[model samples]
Target: MLNVVALMGRLVADPELRHTPQGLSVTTFTIAVDRSYARPGEQRQADFIDIVCWRGTADFVCKYFQKGSMIAIDGSIQTRTYQDKNGNNRKAFEIVANNVHFAGAKNANGNTGGGYANAQPEYTREAPPAAAPSFAIGNNDDFSVIDDEGEDLPF
Candidate 1:
């Protein structure tokens, strides 16, 4: 049997982080995933998915991520039953995130600023190119000669 799920979407709200009795960090947040299809005259729909992270992952998410930040989640779907304040048993479903990654551009502080700033790719210039590689075609006993094919070869 297998149970696995993956999602890439924007957060509907900022993650709420808390500590349990044993001082374990936990965080919960909702992701707004847009539907793949939409009707001719209707607006696109979004699915609100609940997600949970634990320990170091939770702490990292709480510290770096924020509402509207795009993220990728690798996890499994989980369902649990709990009683509400009115004593009604409720069944809840959520993703138990094993790994989370920032899927969008970062802010000046290297964190996803959510809606605090316009989303833009941060660019940095590359260093000067290095010298060309030296090729050795064969062993000493059976040597072979090779020449540069120029830059026209297909990758």
Candidate 2:
């Protein structure tokens, strides 16, 4: 069977690292993923999804990601059965993250600040002059041509 999932969204809350009894690190958090479509007169909708990260991935997320930060996750869907305090059985579904990444541009401290929704391109400069270059391509005296005998051909 094949199971894979990829999601990019803003975190609903900061990830808090925890340790299992076996001393393995873990963290659970939710992200708000916007739906692809909406009714013609309605506002866009978003779904809150639960995500689980383990070990190094958990620690990394807790250290670098926070509430409102955009995150990209690659993982598989997982479901579990458990009993809540009321004694009713329930099923929970979440993404078990295999990889997590920063989804926004880095700020001054080399940390991603605003979410991807407001991220700016990494490189920005003034636009080039509208007119074409003054130099003529074939008439340039700086150009040179070489005759190849094929003996030194790389291919």
Candidate 3:
């Protein structure tokens, strides 16, 4: 049976990372996904989904992502039941995320303690410098010494 699910949405809050009793890493967060269609004269609606990640995935998520950061998750749906504080039974549904990927830019106010702006590249700490190759020939005339015989060409 197939139980795969995929979703792309913005994080509703920062991922909370913790350790299980066995010392395994775990993280939990919520994603806010907008509805595909909007009713006339009505605002678009969003669904808040709970997600859980384990091991290295959990560490990576908590370190890089923040609230309002767009992300894509691939996982399976899970449901569980427990007793609430008031002695009432409660049921919860969540996604057990196997993979998580950054999806889009964050809003201006979404920046948490991280100093970088949303427009900054998420993977790089600094912009790459632009420079001309040291071996580059300035003009086509520089290659005039080449021969068509497929023999060794001088640089």
Residues 50-132, model 1: lDDT tens digits: 99999999998887788888999999999999999999999999999999987887666755544423354667999989989
lDDT of 2 by residue, 77-131 (tens): 9999999999999999999999998886666666573343345467679888899
Between prediction 2 and prediction 3, the one with superior TM-score is: 2
Clashes of each: 0, 0, 0
**What global local distance difference test value does model 1 have?**
0.86
Candidate 1's C-alpha runs over 4 A off are 106-155
Residue 48's lDDT within candidate 2 is: 98
| Sort order, lDDT high to low | 2, 1, 3
Ranking by TM-score: 2, 1, 3
lDDT of 2: 0.88
Off by over 4 Å in 3: 105-155
| lDDT minimum window of 10 residues, candidate 1 | 111-120
Global Cα RMSD, each model: 11.0, 8.1, 8.5
Worst 10 residues of 2 by lDDT: 111-120
lDDT of 3 by residue, 1-155 (tens): 99999999988888889998999999999999999999999999999999999999998888888887788899999999999999999999999999987777544576533334545656747877898677645766555674568757675
Q: TM-score each candidate.
A: 0.70, 0.71, 0.68
Reference-based lDDT, residue 125, model 2: 91
